[model samples]
Target: MAQRILIAEDNDRVAAFVEALLRHEGYTTERTADGIETLQRIGRSVPDLLLLDLRLPRLHGVDLLKKLRKSPVGNDLPVIIVTGVYRGERYARAAQSLGVRHYLEKPFSANALLAAVKDMLPSCVQVDAAPEEGEPFDRHLYQAFSTGFSGTFHFEGKRKATLSFIAGTPVSLRPGFRHRDFGDYLLQNGRISANEYDYYQGAGHFRSDVLVQLGCLRYPELLQEKLAYLTGELLEAFSGPPLKVEQRSFPLSPGLQLFTLNMPSLFHRGYWRSSAPDTANPFPEEVYGQFVAPAAAFYRHVNFLDLNEEERRFVSQLDGSRTMAACLEGASGITPLLRLLKTFGMLVFAHEPLSVEMPAGMPLRLLFNVLEDETGPGGDGPLESFSDLVNEESRDDEPLLPAEPPPVLPEIGDLSLRVRQVFEGMQGKNYYQIFAMEQGKFSFDQLKTHYFKLTREFGPETMMQLAGEEAGMVEDILATVTTAYNTLSDVIKKERYDELLGSEKVGLGQKGDDIFQAQVQFQSGKVFLDMEEWDNAEKALQDACNIAPKNGDYLAHLAWSIYRNPQHGSSPAMREKVRQTLNRALTLDRVPSAYAFKGWILLEGGQDLLAEAEFSKALKLDARNNLARKGLREITEKREQEKKGLFRRMFS
Candidate 1:
């Protein structure tokens, strides 16, 4: 049966083009001009894949996607995002989070669309094709078994395989039963001559070990390459005829070396290769020289060891800035090597450098129009120019005004008095009220929008005219809003806040007590600290300390807050005050926060040894103190790096 695809596009031309292409490729295609009709069709029957356009009538594409993901059928269904206007990182990230695996801007080729469809939906035997031993090898089964299970899979007859896994990801796959040894495997792949393999076999040692002993290979790198080769072979076997598979699990021995393969990327690369053995490079000719290898492939994976002499040199020459064009210039047999490397998920084609020099005094609207016009249907030019515009404006000393002036905020009558009133009654206000949100209904995006507006309207710098008591009140309001945003913006914090709100609603009001008020202020300060609003955190913490003068915990937190404040004057003065405050807190009680803050102060002053000691003391008092643990880890890593440097110098 032919697979079905639903294309949701507003443009009639694009929809017709896509539908014709899919039908030509032996697929049944459905078309809709907007999100509402698409959703209605999907509600009646889910398509095998969804080809969705971002700009749609009745509902936006992203909004429709979010709604689709909530439905039972949409969870695992594939979606290919087709967009023209929506070329922002925020949109891309959102789509990815919603499980959009493929993205194609408007004017995408039929071949590109077909490749994406095949990749997302690999043609395999149905799930019901379990051959008497284990379930069929579908992506779900692959992911499920690989994620956390360690086992040997005994295939039919003389064929069997052993796989080790850590946390549902394949660490390594070792062949079993009728599988060839490393020497034979190497010879079969033409990595070694027949004579070389025979000679290594005669040495009475494993091929890799013998190669290392003879200085023919680096053991670490050669081992990684062997594993990758074996893994690729195993995956190829899985795509063959159905066989009985018996799985057995056993405890993994400690201290064994494991190779971590990004299964998802690896599988995708393998599938693409399988589907299009002779396919040309998907990247444009303009980017041939600009392609760069993923840095993670070097630092994180052992696969970097698999590079041959020329491949190694080529990779080493890629210093992020050097394009493939520049690096592979005049190199022999480079195109084939580049193609092979890309096929194995080793390369990210091109990093477009942003243009910094825009026409001076360009109006924001004209600038946007210029970018949109240049970008065209493919949207590449606009995306790059917009990024460049942002980069240039950020580095510019002068502020560029928007196309239109922002709405003027209503002037505060008796600003000081109003601020003082809000501060006094702040305990009665909830996070929702601070942002002027309707109770019980608001999204994170809504909260963020309102929070920024509130900051601009009543932020500290905007209150330069207010002084004395009024200035202090303005600062307090800023802190309160900052606290609200800090809590409401985070999922965990927001959930906890909602739970607390529910609890408070069911119980008697507790705003009457002084200690409770102080606790609330302290919590608000902690929120600010977490949000990295240093000045606001310091002010709020100081107020908390003032409310409870003898509270050692309050004093210790206040000291740390003051230490982190950039505007707290000279470093020397700040350090001295932090030390004195910590000492006073320690005198009152041996709290871990005091010790941790002391460690921070010591660390900042280049006293690592002393800082380590302070952190140790804090850990002794409270083992769960993260600051103490983090401080110790930093000191240890620094010492290790220093020792490594010393050894390198001595050897040189």
Candidate 2:
């Protein structure tokens, strides 16, 4: 039972940003683009908090707040004003007068927005109260389908159906539509006469089976009719009057027996067949913003929708060149179809005002100053310090490519003289330390927020804006944060870090450091190598390489392990994979093991001359290397046999 939040903003980007941030924290959210719609949603059901934008289309921010205060439904609702339109002292005073204490200007940091939200809505007000049967049916149905909800959902009220799902996938469901019984189905389709149906109806439970015995219904046709009847029931349940739903975990709760039902098809056909509004929220206000198709990878995930030829054509035309309105012209069922696309995340309406690519980040520095002045002493009443909105550049950072692992971070206060002050603060810190979090204290979502907070503050534009900071120094900070994020964000890598942090065997100065952690993994991989556990060795060694890619020894062992892994069958693809890894190892440094492995691959491929050359290189690097020596021995033996055959043929 998550606490719900309403985002009332006309700007799609801003609303989307706020919605994502809140939902990540386990809050249910709804977005409205105008004052009238916002009030309409509130009158139906009030959210725990309202993130109101100042310049709403149908109603102004002040007017909306004024109406809210007088309304019986939302009078005491908490609010945080998020906007770029209103920022002057007069607006601040006007809002303050109306008891709006939390105000965030546009382009505010995620921290600023979240902090304001957290302060006003201190506790998550969970609503476990099931809606009056008809309500939340559509909402829960969409949620269940989209999220792959697992368990039994008992739908009651006007109709009844029990649905059973495994691992969030529906497998069993009894159709609630009982309008047409088998007899009615048979009579309507002219399979049996009216009098025959009446006689068959009296035959009771196994009427269809009874008909098969008699000449009234053929077996194949009967099967088809039965399927049609049951499928009709399923569709009727989905498309007809809303039902009250009771959810219980599967196996523990009484469930309908397993049925071979294609839930996705049922959902798609049911959703479209029924007249329920295809979307849960108001349509996007970005009219001029052209409609865009979702990327292929994203679309593939929901390809279960299995669009027909017409739907596919409609989607193909949404190539970011034409507005949705323009597409609507002469288009039939485009509204529901478009809404369906958006609801399922198959389309992106990067509307007008702001493109889909970015959020409007207004500076928060000015608002903070304004608030500070307004809060001076007794003037502003019960507020003192408040959230500062983040102002960052609209562009995203380039994908971080793996580079040579940096040096192990030193302990703080034991500083580096050459490093800039900004870089110095983080030089000795772990990922958790960078975000001011204690180990294991935060969720992954919280980790993302922390990572986002640092990245936003140190973004290119913001970093350059800082007095005396150079590009190289900014790069240093960004790299450290990015590396820390990469480690602590991954489950396997994070576990290794935690294990490394806890171990007492670490070097005196290198404890809790990234480079030292890589050393730990490399040693672990070497132990796996001793046992000939190639799979385990590859994983551990790969992790080491990830942490310290420049270490030739680590890379060489990883390549050898990959080559020897039993799971990878000896094929051209496998050989190439091994060689690519060895190439990386050799590029880092001329480790004898790397050359020896390369020689083995060449020998396996019958490239005898090339194998000999590689073996020579290995021997030059390390004469005692057993793999290289063995390879040379095998090559000499083959040549001696060839010489013997030639001499024998000549003498005869």
Candidate 3:
């Protein structure tokens, strides 16, 4: 079966060309003119690969790529960027940041397109061709033989250039076009005349606007001729055949400038070494080149005891020749290997392979299962036996009885069934599907829009009935409706409810025990106080206190509720009791209510001065308190008649 590749390009010509190229390469191609349509097609059935053009009619390429990465289906899909406008280094950097695997500039040959496709598809094979005259040799094929390496290569030809690769992928390319910086450096170092530098920089700019702005060379002819000369010079610097791996020592400190040409083979051979810096080269050794051989060898040889029997059997069939497609054929087992290889970095497609190392001494159980068959039926080895012993011992030491199960009240009966039904219906739908809104991030306004739509669908009466039900599971639905109303009304409690629903744990059922205990404590405390049992009331309040220590209202209520109990002893003792309890309550929070309550107790206990001061303080804090106002009036009288007499006397 051919791999499906989706092409998202607005230009008809480019789309047709890409579709044809992919079809010729044995890929099942699908084309969409814009990002919106492309996304819709992906939702229907996600393609195995995506060939993205950055400049689409509706959505730009970078935006489309970001959207694809954000979606579940398209997140990990391989993307090849095809762009006509070369933004140079800036564009290249952006594409690399997005994890783009391959890039094709405009006017690319069919062969170049095919090479890129081959690089990304692990199952595709490369067909060799001879190098043309003055063309630099391709040394990528020799990468399969070495463990790892990094080095600079000088290309000697009509055009001199330097290339750098990291882990088998080209990271930097230099001396293209006019080599503006390079020409400047040469002039500064006396390698070229000032006149030559000025002429070349100007000439280079005339041919390519970017080069001219960069001030590297003057004329296109000069720049091209210089590049050709530099290419030849670099080629001459390659003392041996194009595909040779040499381990040479640097004159600088060994730690400073160590370089490896092909290093993947070394890792495969278990030649693990710390990659540290040296003085000679600031950059670490680059591990570019083919990794298929080493990856295949590791998969074939490593032992993975952790894998299940089926997984092991799948792995045992991994001979180097079989592609992932072949291995997954006729078996529903390919999904696991696809995930495992991706994790192990052993799965390389058409582009550069990533360098992911398995931790030292880590079991290869997951990796090996996909490569080999299980040993036998009773494969419980020493390690398994030891693990079983440890589990048994831990179990035996655990407490015999488990913690009390949560109260199974009738709060969540048929509501669970209704919620489960809704979940089943919306299983694969986006959140927008439930509310019939377009897919997007959840916003306050969006929440209101959906809330109103749901209200209209379910009807106001049904929604009210649902809200009144004891169904705790319907909290989220209630929250959404509440949020909508609160958005228009600005209600604080409803806003808090909305925040609580957004939390990972839904509903107040988890805290039911705590609430029940607090209720029990308050009820018992009140009952004891009514029965004149002062000590019992205190004990009951203490229990409630344990349940909710931070509640100042509860503490104040407990103090007042126990004040006049007969068991509190005689009047003198009761006076001291009132003072202590009121003092404690006042210390907790000096609210107007607390002060008023204390004033009444003080008045009853014959502390007139203290009582008057407390009432005045309460009234000062809250002018509308009727109790404080009445108390203050009783202590002082009005003088309206006296004022009238004084005014009449003054006039006479």
Candidate 4:
């Protein structure tokens, strides 16, 4: 039988969430909204564990616990305090004295809540990703996707991986640390050939764009394959012998590209390869005659598998006057359901303990399929997992890359000019503006997402794109962003940054056209530009340029508007005037876009050689200059780069 837990919380939402999470982990739970109700329930029906919330409707949680400690019924019951109120050492000490070893603050994660609960009353499976013979890597993936966990998964052993998440979704496999051989993963998996792997290995410096040029690999497909490979690697870590593992809350990196993949769908490849009891008949005749119960709340986090009508009916009838033998007799065509439930370990027989027993032989990748279950209790002996074998060999030899660690990317590592432009523009921007947050909006985690995104992008270690003096400017920009994040993060400093952004709003009736007002106009113009209203952008940017002509960003954007404006004819004369405007803008400040605009005009003028030079200059300043790079690609008759998703485009 699943262990019983009692939830004592006054807040309906908190109570509901905690109850659902505990039930999902295969526990029977009871909820009481007040201390009086809590005592009555605990006394009447003893519980295996209790989740106590301090502030109760009828009686205080602390006082109620005191009464429980004095009584025989409630004494020695394990309790974990899940509180939104009554925090601090005083309250903790009081609870500790009352035999509470666990304390979780409100707004906790599903992982944290489950971890605390599992520590007190572990599930039947005990698949906590340690040395135990558990379901291969699939369970870990299932937990992350199912619970919507957002944090870092860190593990170290013979082989390990570090992954980043956002809102429980896996975004990047490795954000900043190690660089593994993705080609080997592909080659060994038969997605690519040895020749292709060798060629890719030789072209270590080639990026997605150049790979397209060489007709070697398509960037998007390669990224997708790499994601698959990393997913496999992460699974392999847990599939093998014991490894040290630790998890902490961490945000996704903005610089890395995130491609969508249905993570649940990726698990079948690993699950069948895991160690499990082999059975021709998963439900033995002797056990079928006995009573059975749901092994877990398996209904949740199982959308990847659909429920058949008969299967649903069979599950609904598990309450009374039913046995596996009866169900098997009634539903003559439910072999698939039986096998599915068996694979998932979703049913347990009364008084029969289940244990994880590994196959005598070593496991092999892709060796066992769903069909293997039909082969009966003693299927073929397992072979060593193929991917694990190859990966182990690859780590030792690494035929492609030098035995030494791969060198840092010569061009600012992973930091591109596009990334720099995205962050550097927010150098002097206020906390709200930098985060693009509206007035009076704050969540420490939300703020953390924006903060991690910016700081990780402008990391000083990867600022090799800039020279010594220019790099100092990047550092200053990083410092400014750091300061803004710190100020907003602290309750006291939140009142003002180094300077307040009170007068930062534009289009209001403000006094003089100072640099501050020009800044307002500039920001408003950028918003219009993002909205693609060329005329409005022109008018607002014209105001900013008139007030602050030396601001190259302002002048360059105004030139962009002049060129984008439909009223501005596409005649050679108009093009020439826009070209001259960009030249003037570049003289004031050499922003990448001005050179990119000049390059585009030259390209349109059929000055291919001159256009290439301008494009190169734009790239030198900002390698991610889309306009410049696109112009060069057009010159060389190559493919246009794929557009980024709105979030990445706007944020990164």
Candidate 5:
């Protein structure tokens, strides 16, 4: 048997990468995202080695290791501690007493990890791996879980269902079976006698809750049974005609998660079991021209076990230019690898990354800083940095400023004459002029390269040195350089800037004043939408509509904003007005949003049939509209429920 290695790490990304590395080395791996699950897994089946992270939920790693040291099974288990915690040497010393033989710091490479595991499990067996990607549905799922990833698995064609995974174990599933309630589940599975179920039904206060409260069944045990039953159902449905399967990496939120059966083990419990499909290239030739990007959560949990030598080489060379063709020169197996990566959703296939609209939109600099603040070192939660900013501003009595005020006064004579000349004259120049480049001439790649070079040569530290002071002046100029890059790099922002610059050159009159005003308001509304400030969005989009009443896009956006704003009560009057606005928008232009929002209104009014029709119309207009697609899904689910209920009534 292949030696099984168990990874106890709360960081999903780190855990996944480690698992992938181990799997490639021919070791079977199981992962737990928290201390509680790790203990349970160890109790159920002992692994050959334990790769542990110190910071874990439910139980701390040092304490858990101490507990394990006292256990018969874990007393002499080979252990390695891998974590990013600062000053973790203190923990290392404590773990050493408990027989943990090795400690690897965060950001360690694959080779180092492989070496450590190999030293501990010298006799581990290796097997030739089956094809891992772009396969039929069942094997794709098996490979995903076996690699120790946790997230939502989506099957987007016939027999669609979305299933949630926690550390390679099935936890929850959506689009649940028809007419399946706790009572039906219990009775059908013979968990409870019919008499017992009838008795519980007579008393009638949530059957499961009552059973637990009365000590007739333990909550944990009951939940486990429930999850097992659901998992069985999901696996059975996995045979739905060769559909497209996509897996996404989800960050495990802080909590004590309930136990779930590992998918591989669950498959062995008699669900549809099958081998992986034949390996033939599924990607089109044009796929090479598309850019591939890592998903948002991929940084934390990346898997490269499936890639071959050539694929590995090509992937390592990805320089943010996702165009596969650009990097595929002389590379073999690159096309199949790209298809696999795209199928697994490890990388996003896009023509280009979407750019933020100008005006009212926060520049990419602020956006990235916000992202870093949330996901960066020591960051605790989503929008953590932005929340801190809001809290700080709320506590202070000062007005919110256009820009962050300088840190403190610094000396001006600190810089050399050349640095001083660059700083003093930087603000007056246009972005292109500041970059010393001509507009419509330089490519984005060229602009990015130039920006990097300039920042490196004349960075903020360089300016501070030249100024001979710690004043915020140098930082201010650095900010300008950053702003210029932001304006020049984004496709939409750069295009708008070019248009404005060209207009200025020709001295165009205010012939399109209304159009300009409407655009400004529309952009503002979009920014509000991005921020989830529905009230502000409504106000801004309302202004846009007022400025250009005939623009169906503006009116449709305004209608959506109004519908989303909680301040506007969902009274009959409000609903009627929203409907009227949507109708007007459709009359002006038959865009998908007008029909989609009209469906939303009708759906809210309990007109399911009408709403379904409207949604269908929207999908006809724009098949890829997610709003319309979701609306149709909801209606279909409701219809399924009614059909199930009718069947139950006739049968029962």
Candidate 6:
């Protein structure tokens, strides 16, 4: 069925262009010229996809995206964002949180639009086909696609098959089976001795099937023994329903397959064993033997003092015979046991009761505690003990022991009061506000003007002392002020304030011209780029680049605007300029926007593979990037639609 697409563009021309393109692809599209109509149209009948513009009439694109996510139908609906304005990290992060799938900057191609749509579609399947019946399970193939499944299945015949589906897709085919057949297969393969199998059954109390495979008994005798045991206990334990195991196959390797088993619904609620057959082991004794020895060995080697008293007592009480719940009951709580066991990687839960083995020392508990203390209610104080523990553990020459705590700092009453005073005065004001300028939008001249006025009143040394003394304040005043100064002066705090703000404003009045001229030139360059005049853009961008040679965006955009002109579009000089600009931009900040533009240029220059790689790189850097999404989508769709037939070749 043809999918319905909605284009919410504020510009009439852009909307018409998109509508025509989608129509040519046989998709029914709805168009809205503003955000208000876009929301209204979606509310009436949600489209499969939405093409949103960042700047729209009535409501902004960002606000609309938020509203769409909250709406029931729009929550999972894919959206492609289109914008002209340069959205930095803040906007990109917000769009990503709202689940914008693709972004298209100005001058995006039709192929980019189509590519994005195809990538986000529900029907897209990217994995290779599952191995045929009788083929060995492949581990590599299983991990290739991201999937979540829980089920067990039984295969009727000898063949192996593959299974694939997205979330919520109904699966009916049985891919594999679970049975006592493993023992027979092992015996046929000569991996175990019959005497060893008998010893395992007699002493280890292994399952009959396992004993049979180990050569303890013939298959017929093992089957009879299993039947007799089942007659007395299995009927009661499995009485609720026959075990219905569902299977899903995942590619684990080129030829190796791994299967996820979904046992009966009874197992889903965390019940491993039933009450009537309490004496009947929930898992095969052979399974218990495989894990129990290692588990005991691990317990013996573990240092009890390293664990809390509660954990020590819990481990000491665990005997091989006791189940996890029974051990928890004896210990009075399962929390510590579960935590310690899981932390060490010694435990795994499955259809049977939890199993444990001695594993490599994990120290995951210590790591978790450290991370928790750093982020938890007590803040950094909790991390002190964790840090000490780590230090103590790292010393190889000495036996591991608990670390001594650091000495607490003495409280300073008057100094604390002074710190409080500095913080309270500067608390609400950001660095820009401190200097009486708007945040984010300010010229060097405006910044300098504010800086001198404030410093003259406060005196440079006193101001520096205040900022330094209150550096430990939680309000982040020092950082804000430093950032503001860096943005404006392009000089370190010590130097800028000492040379400029240290002097009296009256004395500095005559000195403002040189500062003002530098500021004017810088501001004029920004204005030129915004206005899109190539000559002015080049001149201003060059000046900005020279002043802040490390600034990649300025270099990139200057080169980009220059190349946009038809006269310079194909010039070798233009290409070189753009290459240098892009290289610098990448160096300054390999931000999604920079990569998106670079990818677009590469794509236009017939470097499709390089363009795709760049786009992919951009997406990796910022998943919420609309430009990268558009580029990726364009490439993907074009590849998928590329003709392989003789008719296609002939037409081309």
Pick by TM-score: which candidate is best? 5
Residues 1-652, candidate 5, lDDT per residue (tens digit)? 3466888986666777776666556565767766766887687567779998765666667667777888998887888888664235554565566776677888888888888888887533334644223345556566656566678888664335676777666666654421134555565444555665676667854346665655445454466456555755555444223546787887776563544553333432222122122233355667678765445423322331323345444554343443656546656534434444444555555687422122242222222112222232234544222223233333465554436664343322213434555666774567787777777566667777766666554542343233222233344455456657877878797876677566541223467876887798899998998798998898899768755766888888887887777876624334444655666677568989888888887777555656778999999989998889999899778756644453333233
Q: Order of all candidates by lDDT, from best down to worst? A: 2, 1, 5, 4, 6, 3
Error of 5 at 480 (Å): 43
TM-scores of all models?
0.24, 0.28, 0.21, 0.26, 0.28, 0.23
How many clashing pairs per prediction, in order?
A: 6, 9, 64, 13, 10, 39
lDDT of 2 by residue, 429-539 (tens): 667898778895957777778776666555532332233334445555665576678788788989888876675644546645778878888999989988999888998
**lDDT by residue (tens digit), candidate 3, 1-652:** 3466778886677777776666555566667766666776677556667888765555556667778778888777778888775435555655776777677887778888777777776633223624424321323312422223344444454334455443332223355312324555355334455665676567654233343454433343234333433332223222112232222221323343322221222221111011111112211223122222125435433332233344344444443333334334444423333333433455443233334334454433333233222232346532111122123344566643357764444433233445434534543443344555443344557655765555443332222224333222243343334333444335574344345334343234575666576778878887886786778887777667545644544565566655656565443334434544455455445667557767766655444345668888888889887767766665343223423442333233
Pairwise TM-score winner, candidates 3 and 4? 4
Model 1, global lDDT = 0.60
- lDDT tens per residue, model 4, 415-467: 34445556456645456777777656766777778876665555432352344
Cα RMSD (Å) between model 3 and the true structure? 31.7
| Candidate 4 segments whose C-alpha is farther than 4 A from its true place | 1-139, 174-180, 187-214, 227-238, 252-261, 276-303, 306-321, 324-652
**Clash count (model 5, backbone only):** 10
Please report, in order, the local distance difference test score of every candidate based on alpha carbons.
0.60, 0.62, 0.48, 0.58, 0.60, 0.49
Model 5 lDDT on a 0 to 1 scale: 0.60
Candidate 3 segments exceeding 4 Å error: 1-8, 11-147, 155-161, 165-296, 299-316, 319-652
Worst 10 residues of 5 by lDDT: 364-373
Better of 2 and 3 by lDDT: 2
Deviation (Å) of 144 in candidate 3: 8.2
lDDT of 2: 0.62
lDDT of 6 at 200: 52
Clashing pairs in 1: 146-168, 147-167, 147-168, 148-168, 289-324, 289-325
Model 4's alpha-carbon lDDT is 0.58
Q: Write model 1 residue lDDT over 170-245, tens digit each, in one string.
A: 5445452213556655654445566667777787455467766655444443554555565555455433333456
Q: Is candidate 5 or candidate 6 better by lDDT?
A: 5
